[model samples]
Target: MANTTTTTPNAAQDTLVLIGRALIAYLFIPAGIGKLMGFAGTVGYINSVGLPLPEVGAAIAILVELVLGIALLVGFKTRWTAIAMAIFTVAAALFFHKYWSAPDAMKMMQQINFNKNIAIAGGLLALSAFGPGRFSIDKK
Candidate 1:
């Protein structure tokens, strides 16, 4: 005897995944565009953080947040994109949101930002593991 089980498309789950992708994309796409438009300001901020090669950093940020961010939104190469975004988010939190080293007045704000980045990274990791769902170009 043979046993069989049927699998059905989950429209709700797929829609939720698309919405999650959109929300994540919203955070990076505008941020990337802002950095691109204010190239000097972005470089200056990177320099202020005492990171070398601020220009290179800014360019890489633009590429990751803008280009790869759009890819994430469209669910193209989503697993790799999500993984890259997750890693970048964690690195950025560690480098830029060093709340432990922040002044007393700024510590709370920095900590909040750091935690937020970590949470975002968690979401991205989940996306990477589960994939972009049926609504994505990847599924097509």
Candidate 2:
């Protein structure tokens, strides 16, 4: 073949971003299902944490994650869904994982999980502003 080169500054970023969104959506699906099914133990934990309207909050969170995860998976209204999810994730990290001055193991675990969520939320924030790549319903 003749010499050929095809690359763009945004191409890799777009591909990685799409993959990241897909993975996040995939993980959320099961978690959402757990919440949707009223996993009694989980709801109990939420209540124990003193979340206001704990049951209702759990339900809403389930629906938001499930529905928005689906939407994000298909890249439909990608930006909006990403932004909404970003907000939810950040809130969850703050509310549930804000362990300070705890045992080192627990604190480290919480910090890792919390930071992971925040990083994902950051990706979502970028997605919300950038819109999905050419491979999305937002494009169609």
* Runs of candidate 2 exceeding 4 Å displacement: 1-15, 101-105
Model 1 lDDT on a 0 to 1 scale? 0.96
- lDDT, candidate 2, equals 0.82
Worst 10 residues of 1 by lDDT: 1-10
Estimated TM-score for each candidate = 0.93, 0.83
RMSD each, Å: 3.2, 6.1
* C-alpha lDDT values of all predictions: 0.96, 0.82
Write model 1 residue lDDT over 78-101, tens digit each, in one string.
Answer: 999999999999999999999999
lDDT, residue 117, model 1: 99
